[model samples]
Target: MRKEPLLLLILIALILAPSVQGAKKVVYVAKVEGTITEYTADQFQRYIDIAERNNAEALIIELNTPGGLGDAMMRIVSEIQNSSVPVIIYVYPRGAIAASAGTYIAMGSHLIAMAPATSIGACEPILGYSQNGSIVRAPEKIRNFYTAYMRSLAEESGRNTTAAVKFVTEDLSLTPEEALKAHVIEVVADDVPDLLRKANGMRTKLPVKGKGYVVLDFTDVQVRHIGNSISDVLISYLSNPAIAYILLNVGILGLIFGFLTPGWHVPETVGAILLVLGVVGLGYFGYNTAGVILIILAMIFFIAEALTPTFGLFTVAGVASFIMGSLLLFGKGGGSIYLINRETFSMLRIAIIVLAVLLGLFFLFGMTAVVRARRRKPETGKEEMIGAVGKVVEDLDPEGVVKVRGELWKAVSKTGEIIRVGETVKVTGMRGLTLIVEKAEGDAEWQE
Candidate 1:
C-alpha cells in the first residue's frame, strides 16, 4: 500500500515537471539599425504578431537610427500602440541616438529605455534636405504641425510634453541620463541583460487602447531574437531612390542599344529583366495600374524592335515609358514613400530628371557612333580583308607566308594541309600580324 502511494507521487511529479519548465516567460527581441523604412515597419509588425501569438512577456525593439522616412516611422508607432503584447523601445549600444523620427517611435512604446551615453530627440523637420551638413528648417506651417504631433504623442505616453515639443520646435536633444531624469525614458540600461534586470517587476501600460496598465515581470524570461530576413534586405535596397533611379536609366539604355544591333539579343534580354526590376523598385515609392501597364507595353515594344531591326522606331515608345515611370515614381499622387513634404519631393524630381537627361545625351552620342560605323561601306580593299583570296608566296608545310592586300604576311593553314608555292588560299581571318587561311575550293584567279 505504501509503495502504491509513492509510485502515484512520482507519476504526478513527472507530469507536472514538464509544464513547469514550459511555463517559463518569453521575451521577443528585434534589432533595428539604420533608417526606418516601410520594410522595417512591416518587419516590426510581423514581430509583434509573433510575440502576441506566443503570449510573450514583452516585445523589445533595440533601436539605433539617425532618422528616416516620417511616414514609415508613423506606421511603426501605430503598430506599437495597437499591439497586444507590451512593446519596449530600447535605444541600444552606447552612443546610439533616436533622433528626428526616431523620437516619435520611442515615445509610442509602452516602455522606453536607453543605454548609457545614448541620446534622443532633435526631430526638426527640414526643407528639401540638409546638404553638406547644413540644416534648412521647413516652413512655419510644417513646424507647427509636427510640434503639436510630438506634444500629443508625449502626452499620451505620460512623458514631458514640453521637452517633446522642443524636440520638434527647437530641435532639442537629451542624453540617456537627462532623459531618465526628465521622465522621458523609464530606464537607463547598459545592455539587454541590464535592461531586463532593471525593468523586472516594473509597471507599464498595456499598448492596446483601453486595456489599461499592467505590471511587467521580466524575471527568468526567454529572449528570442528576430533578425532581418533576405526579402526585407532586398526591399530595403530597392526602396533607395538613387539605386532605383540608376537601374531604370541603365535598363532603358540597354534595350535601346540591343534594338539597334542585329545580332544575339543579350542586351535586349538583360534590359527587359532590369526594366521590370526597376518598375518593382519604384512600386515601393508608389505606382498606379495605368502607368504600370504603359511600362509593360514599352517593354513589349523593346522586344519587338529587337526582333526586327528598326532604327529609332521605338524611340517614342521608350521615351513614353521613361516619362511615365519617372512621374509615378517621384510624384506624391496615391501612396507615400518617405512622407517627405511636397517641396522636398519636387526638388528630388527635378534633380533626377536633369541628371537623367545628361546621361541620355551622353549615350546618344555613343549610339550615333555605332550608326556611323554601320553605314560605312565595306567595299574597299582594307575593309574587305577577312573574306579576300590570297596566294601562297612561300611553301606551307603548315605554317607559311601568303600575299594579300598587295603585301606578303605570315599565314597559318586552317587544317595543316600541305600546299606548294603559287597555290591560292582564302584569308579567313586576321590574328594579330598573321592571317588564318583555308584552301580555296575553286581554281579561281587570285587577286595577289
Candidate 2:
C-alpha cells in the first residue's frame, strides 16, 4: 500500500510539473506603419527588450511600409533573425503591404502572416547620384548579389523561392490569399485578435545566443499592442520623401537668409537643425557624395557673393551648381531608393535658378550704381570743395579761411596767391579740411 501511494504521488507531480515549468504565453504586437528609419530600428529594439524582460512568448510585427534605407533594413533583419523570441510579421488591418526593405524584414521573421487584401514583394537595388546632375543605377553584379541575398532569406523562412525571385527579377506582387497559396506566407488573419488566436499553439524555432536552436510551442497566447509613440510617428513623417525635401529646402533657404541678414538667430538655429536632420536623412538614404560636394560648393559660392564683389560670376556659378547638384542629389534608385522625384527636381532647379538670377541682377545693378555714384563729383561735405569756386572768408596770404558750400574752412593758396576776405577764389585741392584755393579769373590783388 505504501509503494502504491508513492507511485501515484509521483504521477501527479509529473503531470503538474509541465504546467508549472512551461513559459507563460504573451504576444507582443509592434506596428510599423511608415518609412523605416534608424528611429524605427530603435523602436524595434525597444519592443524586443520589453518582450524579453516580460518573458513574452512571441512578437508580432504588423508592417506597412513603402520602403526605406538598405542599411537600416539590414540592421532590422539582423535583429529579428537573432532574436530569442519568435517573431511573426503580419501585413494586417487590410490594405497594408510589405514592399522593398519591408519584404526583407517580413521574410526574416520566424513566421509571416498577412491580412486579407494585404500584399508583399518588390526588391530592387538603387544607386546614389554623381557630380553632374545624373542618375546612375547600381551595377548588375551588385543587384544580382542583393537579389540572391533576398532569395536566400525567403528560402530560409520556407517561403516560395520562385515568387521571391520574381519580386526582385520582375517586381511581382500578390494579395494575402495568393501569398498564402504561393507559400510566401503562412496564414491570413483579419485583425490582431484573430492573428493571436491563429498563432496560438504554433511551433516555432528560435536560435539562442549560445545554444544552436530551441523549439518553442506557443500556448494560451495573449496579445499586447506596441503602437508607435508620438515621437516615433513624427520621425516617421519627417523621413518621408516629401517632408524631407521640404525640410531640406527650408533649411537651405534659412541658412541663406541668415547669412544675408546676419544675427537672425531663429533662422540660423532652425537652419542648422534642419540641415543636420536633412544630412542624416541623406546619409541614411545613400545620396551621392559627389552631389553633396557640389551642394557644398554651391553654398560657398553664395557666401562669396554675399561677402565679396564677384561681379555676379559667383552667383551665376552658385545657381548653376545648385541646379546641377539638386538634380544629381538623388540617383536612379528607381522608385525604390529615390528620396526626391524628377518633377520635384525640375521644380527646385527652376525655382533656384530664377531666384538666383534675380538676386544676381539686383546685386549687379546695385553695385554698378554705387560705382557710378562714387565716380561722380561729391555734392556735400569736405569733398564738395574739390574744383569748387569760393570766396576768401578772411585775408589769406598763404593760409586763411574760405567759404565753400555755405561753410567757412581754413584755406591755403596752392599757387602762392594772397587774397582779401571778400575776394573770390577757387578750390584746387584739400588737406585736413583745409581748402587749397587759387585766385579766381582776374583777381589782381592775388597773383602767383
Candidate 3:
C-alpha cells in the first residue's frame, strides 16, 4: 500500500515537471531592419501569429527603417492592433531609427520603447512623384486620413495625439529622450535585457474582440528572436532601390549586347528575367508611372544609337533621358533611402552616363571596326596568299622558292614531287612563313 502511494507521487511529479518548464515566460521577438514591404509585413505577421499560438507573454518588434510602402505599413499596424497578445515596438541598439511609416507602427504597439541615440517620426506621407520629378505630398483628404489614423493609434496607446498629428502635418521628429518626455514612448532602454527589466510589471491594455480591455502584465519575459528565412532575406535585399535600378539598367545593356552579337541566347535570357523582376519590384514599391515610361524611353534611345550612326546625338539624348528618369525613379523620402537620396542619385547618374558613353563607343567605333575588318580585301595577309597561282622560280626537291604577288616566298612541294623552274603551282598552306605548294592542273609532267 505504501509502494502504491509512492508510485502515484512519482507520476504526479513527472506530470508537473512539463508544466513547470512551460511556466517559464517566452517573448517572441522580430527584428525588422529595412523597408517594410509586403514581404516584410508577411514576415512580421507570421511572427505575431507564432507568438499568439504559443501563448507567449508578449511580441516585441525591433524596428530600424527609413520607411516603406504605405499599404504594407498599414497591414503591419492592423495586425498589431488586432493581436490578443501585447505588442511592444522598440527602436533598439545605438544609432537605430524608426522614421516615417515606422513612427506609425511604433505608435500602434501597446508598449513603445527606444534605445539611446534613436529617433522616431518624420511621418509626412509622400503620396507620389510629380510628373516634373518632385516629391508630392498627400492631398488634403489623404493627408487628413493619415493624420486621423495616426491620432487614433496615439490615443489608443495613450500617447500624445497632438504630437502624433504633428508627425504627419509638420514632419515632426523626436529623439528618444524627447519622445519619452512627450509621452510618445513608454520607456527608453539601453538594450533588450534592459528593456525587459524596465517593462516588468508594466500593465498595458490589449483589445479584446468584444470585451472592453484585457490588462497584460509584462513580468519575467524571455526574449526569443525569430530568424528571417532565405526568401525573406532575398526580398529585403532586392527591395533596395539602388539594386533594383542597377538590375534594370544592366538588363537593358545585356539585351543590347545579345542583339548586337546574334546567336547568343544567354545574355538575352538573363536580361529578360532581370528586367521582369525589376519592373515587378518597381510596381511593388509603387513607383510613378511617368518615371517608368521615361526610363523605357531612355532605353529606346540607347537601342536607336546602337542600330544607327547618329554621331553621338542619340547617345547624348539617351544619357540625358537616363539621368532624368533615374532622378524621378523615386523622389526624396519616398521609399527606401537607399534608392532616392541626393548622393546616391547623383552617383548613379554619373555612373550611368559613363556606362552609356562606353556602350555607345562600342556600338559606334568598335562594331564599325569589326565590320570594316570583315569587308576589307584580304591583301598582304595569310588569307590573301591562298589559291594564288605562282611560278616555281627555283627547283623543289621538296624545298625551293616561288614568286607570287611579285614577291619571293620560301616554298615546299606538298607531295614531295620534283618540280623544275618555270612550272606553275598552287599555294595550299603556310608553315613558319614557308608556303606549301601543290602541283596545279596542266602543270603535271611539264617537259623539263
Candidate 4:
C-alpha cells in the first residue's frame, strides 16, 4: 500500500509539470516613443537582460520614433538580433511610425508586429554628417550599401527582402496590413496581450532564449512592463538637441554675465558647471570641433572687449563668431545627429541671429563708453589719452607697464627710450591697449 501511494504521487507530479511551466511564463514589455539614441539602446538592453535572466517568453519593445543617430539605431538592432530571448518590435499606439532608424530596428528583430494604423519603412541611409539628414540625398554608394544591408536583414529574418530593399532605395512606407501582406511583418495586434496571442506558434528564423527555428508558444502569459529608469530620463534630457542647444547657449551667456560683473561668484560658479555639462553633451554627440572652438573663442573675445583696451574689434569678432558657431555647433557630426530638418534649423538660425545682434549692440555701446572714458581729457592738443603722471612698474623697452590714476596700464616709450622699472613717467596719450609714456621731469629713481 505504501508503494502504491508513492507511485500515485509521482504520476500526479508528472501530470502537473507542464501546467507549472506554463504558469511561470511571462512576457517583458518595454515602450519607446522618441528619437532613438544610445540611451534608448541602453534602456532596451536592460529590459532584454531582465527577460533573458528570468527566462521570459519574449521581450517586446513597443516603438514610435522619427529616427535617430545611425550608431544608436545599429546598437538597438544588434541587441535585438543577438538577444537570447525572443525580441518583438511592435509599432504600437495606433498611428505611430517606424520611420528611418525605427524601420531598421524593426527589421532586425526576431518578430515584428504592428498595431492598427501603425506604419513602417522610409529608412534611406543618411550620410552620417550631411548638411541635413532627413531630406538630403545620400550618395549612390551609400544607397547601394544600405539597400543591400536592409535586404540582408530581411533575408535573415525570412521576410520579404524586396520590400525591405525598397525601404532604403525608394523610401517606401507601409501600414500594418500592407506590411503583413508583403511579409515585411509577421503580425498585427491592438495591444500587448493581443500581440502575444496572435504571435503564438509564429515561426522565427533567429534563435530565441537559446532555441532555434521553432514556433513560439505565448498563451496565458504574465506581463511585466519595464519603464524607464532615472538614468534614462537624465540621459534623454541631456542628449536632446533642443535642450543641449539651450544648455550650451545659456551656459555661455552665464559665463559672459559673470565676467561682465565680477566679484559675484554665483554666476561664474553656476555658469562653469552648466558650461561643462553642455560641452560634454556637445562633444559626446560629436558636434563639429571647429564650432566648439569658435564659441569658446567668442567668449574670450567678449571678455577681452570688457577687460582689455580694444577698438571695438573684439566686439565685432565675438558677434560674428557667435553666429557662425551657433550654426556649426549642432547637426554637424555623426553620432546622435539631430536638428536636421529645415524647419527646425530655420528657427534655430533665427534665434542665433537675434541673440548675436543683441549681444553685438550691447558690447558695441560698452566699447564706445570705454573710448569716451579714455578720451576724457580736452582734445585741443591731446590725442587719445588724458595726461596723468605715475610710476613705472615694469621696464619700458618701447613697451612695458605704467601706473596712472592708481591703475596699471600697458605702456610704450613715447620716444623709443628704454626706461627701467621704478622710474617715474607721464601718460602723454593712449591708443587701444598701450599707453604712450614719457620720462617725468626730475625723475631720479630707476632700476639698473
The most accurate candidate by TM-score is 3
**Candidate 3 global lDDT:** 0.78
Q: Which 10-residue span in candidate 3 carries the lowest summed lDDT?
A: 332-341
Winning model by lDDT = 4
lDDT of 4 by residue, 1-448 (tens): 7899999999999999998877688989988878777777878889899988888888899999988777888888888877888888999988999999999899999889999998899998774433454455677997887788788888888889889999998889999999999989998999988888889988775666457765787877888998888877767677765567667877887888887888997887888888777776554345677677888898789889977758788998998888778777764453235445666566666777878888888888888887788879664334524556778889999899887666688999999989998788877787777889899888433222
Instruction: Please count the clashing residue pairs in each candidate, in the order shown.
Output: 0, 0, 0, 1
Residue 296 miss distance in model 1 (angstroms): 13
What are the clashing pairs of model 1? none
TM-score of 4: 0.73
- Alpha-carbon RMSD, candidate 3: 6.4
Q: For candidate 2, lDDT tens digit of each residue in 300-359? A: 786676666556787778767765665556643332234544554556556656655665
Of the two candidates 2 and 3, the one with more favorable TM-score, higher being better, is 3
Q: Give the TM-score of candidate 1.
A: 0.69
Between prediction 1 and prediction 4, the one with superior lDDT is 4
lDDT of 1 by residue, 1-448 (tens): 8899999999999999999887889999998877667777888899899989888888999999877767888899899888888899999988898998889899888999999889999999864332232455677998888888888888887888889888888889999989989888999998888999999988774345445676888888999998788887777777666566556656876787687774979988888777777767665654355545554566555555444435646544654565565555443334233234455456656755775465444444544555676778776553477777889989877889999768888999988888779888988877777788888879655885
Runs off by more than 4 Å, candidate 4: 1-23, 128-134, 259-263, 283-285, 309-311, 331-339, 365-448
Estimate the overall C-alpha local distance difference test score of candidate 1.
Answer: 0.76
